[model samples]
Target chain A: MSDVTALHPGDTGLSVATGRTEALTGIAAGLAWLLAAVAAAAFDDLGDWLETQNYAIGVGVFGLSFIVLGLTGRWFPRGAAWVTRAGPWLIALGLVLTLWQLAAAKLGWLPQPFFPPPQGILEVYTFEYEELASHFLASFRLLAVGFVIGTIAGFLVGVSIGWSHKAGYWVHPVLRFIGPLPATSLLPIVFFAFPSSWSASIFLIALAAGFPVAVLTWSGVANVNTAYYDVARTLGVKPLGLIFKVAIPAALPNVFIGLFMALGAAFSALMVAELVGVKAGIGFYIQWSQGWASYANVYAALILLALLCSGSITLLFRIRDRLLSWQKGLVKW
Target chain B: MVAVELRPEQPAASAGASLDIENVSHAFDLDGSVLRVLDSVSLNVEPGEFVALLGPSGCGKSTLLRLIAGLEPPRAGQLRENGQPITGPHPSRVVVFQDPTLFPWRTVWNNVALGPEAQGSLKQQRERVDATIDLVGLSQFAKAYPHQLSGGMAQRVALARALVNDPEILILDEPLGKLDSLTRLTMQSEIVSLWRSKGFTSILVTHDVEEALFLATRVVIFSERPARIKADFRVDLPYPRHRGDPRLAELRRESLALLGLAASW
Candidate 1:
């Protein structure tokens, strides 16, 4: 990394290509004009029908977005103005849509759901904060317990099978028969067999996520240079020392990648598991809210889940980076 | 850093070991047929002696060095280090691989310090690491990794790492064979200077006849495969002799001819 410090940014492979920037700008300007024309023409008579048509509304917004993109692409593709202009552009568009929703609903404008209005969603977030937080906590707790157990167990099993042929030989026969079977499908069986509690949720998460970590970890350990083994042998390192010092450090970079994959799978599994014979968690809240016809709250839960999933992944990435800072920029994803 | 400069070398008296090879033979299975790599090859090195084994590729020069270093056991014969059969790799015998083979994960100091910390007293080992770092002229690059060093620099670090242990015999597996010609000459000179200063028994396995003649007191030439000692020629030339120097060239021709590489000269 220190060796790379002297190379200039423009010369780097990282910098974006100039041609791509030029093309995008040209497209954005053309789009903005087309959108402006559609709105201008539709404003006269077919405005009500145009808003009522989801397809038309989608196309109009898309065309207008391209216009903005074209302007930026031509003059300010990735500059501060491009990002700064986006907020005002979106607010203005939202204001127009809201005004249209009020007028168009009377005139039978865009489909009923399309204009649920920002105020309704905001009411769900601010007024129902306490209710959403508990659901958030429930899902997070299940994920925390399950992901941690699954990741650690997977890493250990992976290292064991990867480091020794004996471990691989003895465990591989059973692994072949069992590992390929989907762990998620067994959640129903587990739900029926075990009491409906956090234990079952944790178990479900662990089962679903464990396999990838083990397999990826095994590959990482097995693929290191054989000369590393020879060097360790010459140095008279004992078996345990070799595994700990040589194999683990060499395999960790790969193992972290495996963990990242396993994490996403774990969260997905947790969501499905939370819905089974459960009355808590974000998934449960979405179902409960839909039953009550609180569509705004249901959408809010879905958004919250998306935000949580994104946050957990980002958090795990930070932890992985910290653990393996020796391998800087190693976690490219 | 303390730099203790030696007055001069008494090449025989201080060169590290007296190794006894008694009828060592090694064979491998090639397509269900047994192929011999070394055939009853035997040599002896007195303390502080420099021996260069010269041969072409597929020759058992490296195989013989590994045998002496206890990298692999001989099938037929015994290798005696101080009147005992050589077993597995020992700290007393360190190998400098052609690629340097320094551990990339460790800094220059830690890599060299590995052997001493493995076998010697802790306080003594740490001091030895610093001394060897200075000896190899890598004191400034102590914090650097092997990948950060050039080919010549890495090989020097390998040499320093092997030397840090204060090994009895230094076995070089063509350690400088990959360097450019100018660097090779400079390295060869540096190696000789180090050997003279440290007084370690050094065995260099190389195909270069001129290098063998310039560096070794006794140059042992080997056959192509099933390599056995074809001839052992003593240079009788003084230290730091150039390849073009008449006396060294005369010996180089003799060693080359011994291996059937040169026409009548």
Candidate 2:
């Protein structure tokens, strides 16, 4: 038993003694951030910029918090464990921030307008937050509507094809022909055909998300265990029961896979649609900023989009984990 | 007032239903070629009889059970249950297959509750499901998932799932085929007791000779693919028969000989 525990560290509550290195990393990260703040305060920017006081204060506060966390690790063991896990990432981020500040802001080595200092991006957020937020909300509304409709329609289509030979025969050929075409390629035609740009964007997003969902859900339903159907059949279950009770539940793991793919594709389609078809979104904000040649706004909007993508995907996985808890460890994310 | 007529009680009909498999021949089309499995097999089982069909692996015994369960119709034959032509799957004819085949998503209670739920009778028969789960000695595990179960435990849950329906004809397709030896021994006795108590007509297909001798009232042996009936005989032993009984040993030896493994015995 001891040998087994030795082989699998942390299995028997014998987690490796850690946090010392993490504390060291935390202190180093704090020093790096403080140095970056000093550079921001001490140097003059090569590009047109706002006063560096707020940015320097923000960096200094972040540095102080890290230093406190590093010094007071004994009080919160859980927090310490988290810090231990994130030590390398924290260190890397701090060093990168310091280097970026020195390279772009202090020294005039990098090109102006293209590679603005960290403060330039931060200033965009500080001043133009309201506009960015409105754009985010618009994107959110469009994405939510399109994604829900696409998921439902795709799931229904998949089920119909998977469960019925007639449906499969009729729809499978069409799906094969059109499913692989990127929704963005039809942008000009779609925008011209629809009554409104918003509707066209919605349609494009749905098209992008729906194809993978339908194909994957079809395969999921088609590949159910025959024994499950037999069991249900012997229990006097009807055809509908076989599809809903037996097939759907059995195919859920695969359905989740389809949903993940759909979400990723939906995001791509959303950005493209917003870029060309729609007037207001994060993608639109980036395009608008690019037109004005304000690289700082573009950078800010891109970071926001990144955060949104990460957050939405994380939420999707959480829901999947809860619903398919029985299938934990069976399929890797 | 309308006149109401009363009929006399017929206990036999309620106890178990008789099964008749007449001239059953089955084949599967594999790559445009017909692979014949069962050839002109006929067997009539009396109500409440425990009949065991023993044959070589892949000799179409399971296919025969499937036909009896009305999962699939025989290529050329008629199956009648209680003198009515079998059409399709019915709740009264439940099967405990070799693998547990329990839905991983459902708990033990829900898995056993499948029959009543599918039949749209779960609301009233909820207690019956619990009682059935308790019968299989898994009351504590009623809420446990299939993946959480050991092989024997999962098999017991499968048995409970079949029993919860109160099937008149319990078709067991090698139900105990995959259990460990010790669990298999325990389950063999459990099956016998359940049959005696419930008085359900049982048709078990297994490869174990000793298991057949121990649990079944009559043992039917069949030949290889395109299977033909080799022998049919009654065990004639009373319930709770000893494993070391001289008569059982004699019967086992005879059964092995019929299967053409006499030299080993």
DockQ of every candidate: 0.28, 0.74
The true-versus-predicted C-alpha distance at residue A115 of model 2, in Å, is 1.2
Give lDDT tens digits, candidate 2, residues B1-265.
1111112222233457899989999999999999999999999999989999999999999999999999998899899999999999998999999999999989999999999898788988888888889889999999998999999999999999998888899999999989999999999999987887777899999999999999999999999998999999999998888999999999999999999999998
- Per-residue lDDT of model 2, residues A222-321, tens digit only: 9999999999899888998888888998888888888889999999999999988889999999999999999999999999999888887888888988
- Per-candidate TM equals 0.77, 0.93
lDDT of 1 by residue, A248-310 (tens): 877887887887888888877887876764679998898877777777677788889998988
Worst 10 residues of 1 chain A by lDDT: A44-53
Among residues 3 or more apart in sequence or in different chains, the pairs in candidate 2 whose N, CA or C atoms overlap within 3 Å are: none
| TM-score leader | 2
In model 1, the fraction of reference contacts reproduced equals: 0.11
